[model samples]
Target: MKIEAHDKQIQDIFSLGYFQIPRFQRPYSWERDEVENFWNDIINDVSENYFIGSMVVYQERKPYFGIVDGQQRLTTITLMLSAIRNSFLRLGEDNLAKGVHKFVEQPNIDNEAEFILDADTSFPYLQDHIQSFNGLKIDCDVGIEEQKLKNAFEIICARLEDEVPTSNSESGGQISMFPVDVPDPILKLKEIRDKVLSLKLVFIQLDNKSDAHLIFETLNARGRDLRTSDLVKNLLLSKIKEGNAKLDSAKESWNSLIRKFDDASESEIIDSFLLHFWISEYNYTTDKKLFSAISKYVSEDEKNANDLLKKLNHAAAIYCKLIDPGAHEWSREETDVRESLKALRLFKVKQQSSMTLALLRAYYEKRLTLRNLKACLRKLEYFHFVFNAITSQRSSGVIATTYSSHAISLTGAKGNDDIQAIISSLFNSLRTKLPQYEEFEVKFLELSYLSSKTKNKGIIKYCLSKQFGDKFGGIDINHDAMSIEHIISESTMKDGLSSDVVGSIGNLLLVDEKTNSEELMNLTVSEKIKKLEGKGYPLAKALVGEKFPESSGVQDRARSIAQHLYNSVQL
Candidate 1:
């Protein structure tokens, strides 16, 4: 590879024309505090110097180093230069203004030798600063917040006064500079600017004509964090280079999925889409770890991985379309639609579950048949609520309550085998219940299966509150104090207990913590049952009449409790 080295004069860097800064480059908007911090860093000598990194410029029909990593610094410098130029114009220093203007103007396409003004370049921030300056007036009432911008302008003016060389002419004539006095408020502006420009910064210049893509990957891999979307884009670029038709088709399909969400910027859509993919396909949870893995993998033989990525992209696109027809708009919402999709995808991948997709299909199909968009939207809202309840940091009790509320609406007086079975039951329930009850049904059903242990606890409480209350004397059903004590501890088991015996819901109880600790602590499930029997409340008889009556054996006892719990809560 060819190697070249030269110092990139601060005044000579070109703008990275028309490219939108990717949203994934930084989180949300930089708040005022961060902006103020940046300003403080510039004013203080903490960071004495800044370098605007080199970038690749598509000049003269060939790509060359334009500006790499220093875009932020370069943009800021251009803003300052523009401010200086405007200040000179305001002060009536026409000649000095021209000199300032020389640094801001764009270079001619054919004349590469022209000393184009850096301020005149088409950088967005530079343009905004210049426009702001031109709009300012001494007599105009500027807001307090705008005072910072005004101060920046005044500082630029002072710096101009300090930098422009004085001129004298022969033939008995002398030129005078602008007459603006150095304001005490802006006295330290020159010092701040000089200190900012004096700090040393290192830049490793790679040969522009070499495999720049590989260099870019290496640079990203070295120390910087690559966002999931960035990794996806890099993978896409690598796939395109591989010259595969299927990969190209998949890319186009993915693009179509993103284009559907026209409200979100491309990067926002892409990032959300990639997050969905990583969670679904690779079962990855953290975005950082996923990006790092993909980055490493793509940096290797990205071409060879094209087929797998294409398949994943295709699956992701279909999933996105199903969940978010509005595409980007749906993804951008604060609601956990992406996470919901991720959870759904994981269910499909890990458990062979298709309830989510089935529900979506049922919703749309039902809506189309009934010609009720409002109903569909309502269902969608309920789905959103249930999904959030499960995925959010909800307490197990709260989740169980929410799930029960939703499930009862669908299953009614009869329960089902699984969530999908409940879904069908729910639709039937919806047929009879009022429209408003639909959400309650969905939420109850969704949370019902979140955790078997949680469900069992809820079940035992429901059974005791309905059955043994008052009959069991002063036994207060404290749901909060209820614990799911294993009748036979798994730790003490020789041959593992069957679901009927120790693992069944019948084997569990909603006993108070004090009773559980004092009477049953360290006891095996069989021992605990024996102690409860001694207390004139045989475990089998306690739950026998409630639901499952076959509590004779250990397995039967477990099943009896679970059956009773399940039955008591069935709508």
Candidate 2:
């Protein structure tokens, strides 16, 4: 494996050779912010030569190189050069325009101008608009890479117009780099061309495909900080033999997964997907240990890698549904299962993913019915509300272990009777660990749940919303407009009771801002209770006859409310 690392000017790198973005590579996805940052960095730095970071290329043959990294920067630079060339042509500086265009495209043996950068979907767009002397607006239906190229071109053109406009333009404006009418326009364009051509970049060339893949893994792990999922992908891709059928199949499956998670960051979506996938397959893997766990189980052989990839492809569908319950097609076909998953998302207990993953695996394997899946979800809801959300016995690790254990047990079961027994044993196993009614009520009363600004505010809101959960279609409160109201005002505490009790669940109600200040503020306890009785929230209505704040009567009322909330959950 031969390797060379040295510095090359931006112009020299693209002067004669051609580079291809591999089919497995992600598309050109740099957005406006990244383009603007690159532009500003070049203009703001005062050094004689600005060094953009490393670029790794695999020397395929004589002049064609496969880009292993740095596609984003190289693509953006080409767009800037294209903008400069177009600007000069618009200014009627034909000689300067031709000079700048040479850096963007090189002539082939046939003497036709060939673009240096050859992206899969973005190459045509770049060739048509960016490689042309005339700038054209793109309004056609295109993929994300094409859109990104268009956006970069527009930004570069706008910036150049503001910084160094030509004489024939409508408003000949010259701003930051030069005072208005400071230098010759043609000379200025030539200077910009020289600076761009002289920009320094580190280039690493690899001799063979295996060496290129190794350097790709090493560089991303240490330098650019590969997202965890991308690291897993690189590892798996490295295992496949070159030119194998599984390579294309794996790429297709991986690309489909990325498209499904288009709205989320690759790290977040893929990491979460991997966690659920591992749990469903192996029954035990934490978020932090996911990649390592996978690395241990999936051997560095073609068959094992292919099997793992196939499982990942299948599990990716279930993982997408777990992230977005509404996007699941089954959500439309099965109402109960849909509602259960939606409620899980609303709850936002990420640890519950273990149990949800288990239930989904059962459903997919046909060992569990849709009815049983909903039943299992109810048990999860009860566990989350009572122990994870409401009580002091909260530990995500405990919940994860419980669910993971049950998943393993379920996977090994023989028949439907065994499946039912395992599901029954799941609840029974946690009976001793789960908080009972009295313990739950006591903890619930002690909590400053509604008044505290903790995340539990959402959980309490969920509980209150479930009173009308069916009618309101599940926790449909406009959170931005909601507030926690005190029946006995903070300013009217006569007994000098601890201020801590002023905001406890005993005196709290969820209300709109207007109602809190107008009807309930500064009222005597009995007057406030009278006003509260007329309010619509069930928690507020339950507080009609309580005498004073934080009294045993209020605690009793809180206990009752807690019991009511517990009963309201479907379990």
Candidate 3:
């Protein structure tokens, strides 16, 4: 790529030509902290020609270029200039304000106002309101971007106000007048304005559009990472026209996907969705390399970009459901799928999600049967229970690779038989990775729930409900039933049992809140057995049949429970 690079002052760059940041570029996201840092940089190096950074742009029309990078700093510089101009206006420095106003905007041949740094993201809010010469316009919706521009202007105004000398000074809670002879505030403000204009940066001018794409990858690679979604959004929408139907529709679709994770950061939500969805369809990838992987897959091909966009749009809703299943309802016939989803979530088994996303997509597309999907979920739940929860094993990265491979296989296969084969392979692979029964039982025996064990809130209930769930008289096993009755209470512990043993899964039971509080609060072994009798729970019968000791009995019971839960797995 051919490049012409030169170190230029901020004032010199603005004088060369009108510049525009592509509309699809990330919005003016520099909030208070970033603005403050910019202000401090100027003030701290008040006397020096401070070197800010580099700016990259490509020629679009003659004398107009598209900003490839450094939009945040450019937008911020414009905001600061506008703020200084407004300050001059308020101080009745009309001539000085007009001089600054010329830099903010210039009159074109058509006699219309043209801002030196045209930004599509901030648009009318930046030009019409924050940088407007006449009056404030509250005509448009003030979204986050608009609000940020408004705030930045206010912040600069406040910072400028802080620099002016006050007539009175406070010492020891007493106010006194200051002697005359402080530097003129207007002159000080002008010094800041000039310092901003002189800020130095290396300017690299790309002669054509393709050069911008060639260099875009390395522009922000040196600094803190650019948000992956931001890069993806820019890549897709750069070639799209501002007011075109395709652009508007695509923008709305992207915005809808964004809204799905309204409560999450775009990086956390969309970035995560893209990576998992990619794993489901393509090969495995990490968050750091997701953008590069995507760019390679969709290289310079609009059709590929559009196809990926549609796939992303489809996967987005499903991705949100995978993260949270209960929020969306399932059909009556898919009750098993619903329960399996809840169980996987409760189990905190995220390694299963990529494969699960694939299975769900196939099922939804009607390419894979519902029965097969349920079987996959069941196998996944069982494997994770043994592998993650019961054995307390590390993820080891191989499990992710296995799931990712199966996830890739599930996509674009012939039919259910093909998908079922993939599912069967996934289970068989997972089975080989499981620990032996002796090892599994030993690890399971270590389970305790005194506080937040297994990264699950109701793990004790999860275990009890899974074991004696049918005995709950059809109550939802997932719920706590308003209470979990901890056997061997304080009195029982005072006798012999340690707290760890007392809180072990074997010593816990899920019962009605009222029953736990009324009949089973501080029961000894005999008392617990008596109260637990006639409860129609086989767990109760087993406990009653054994002569229970405080310490070793819990381990014995845990072993028995482990054997039952572990042996029941189809593997």
Residue 407, model 3: lDDT of 92
**Candidate 3 C-alpha lDDT tens digits along 1-571:** 6788999998888888788886456677887999999999887895568998899998967778888888889988988898888777766667878888887888776887888888755667887886777746768867667888889888877887787532232322211232347666568778988999999999999888766765675675554646788777766654433467456866766677676776454466677788888888989988788888888877766677777877888988888778877778788678778767877877777787789899899888988888877877877887887777767789878988898888999886877678778878888898889888998877776667654344433555666666664434554443545456666674555667687787777776666777777877776766776666656544543443345666667777777778777877685
lDDT of all predictions, in order shown? 0.42, 0.70, 0.75
In terms of lDDT, the best-performing candidate is 3
- Candidate 1 per-residue lDDT, tens place, 1-571, comes to 4434454444333332222222112212223453445445555445434543444321222323333344444444444656555544544455654554555553455644332322212233323445333433334433322343445545544544455422221222222332456333122333443443443444444454234445445555543434556555545554454347345554455455445444444455556555544443334334456666666665577463565566554555444554454343442332244333433332222111122332333333342222222233334333333333222222333332223344233222232245345545544543432223334333332322112336533433443443343234554344445555554554443565344344444445556576677888767555666677677663434555423322345444434433343333212
lDDT of 1: 0.42
TM-score of each: 0.42, 0.77, 0.81
TM-score of model 3 vs. true structure: 0.81
Best by TM-score: 3
Count the clashes in each prediction: 40, 0, 0
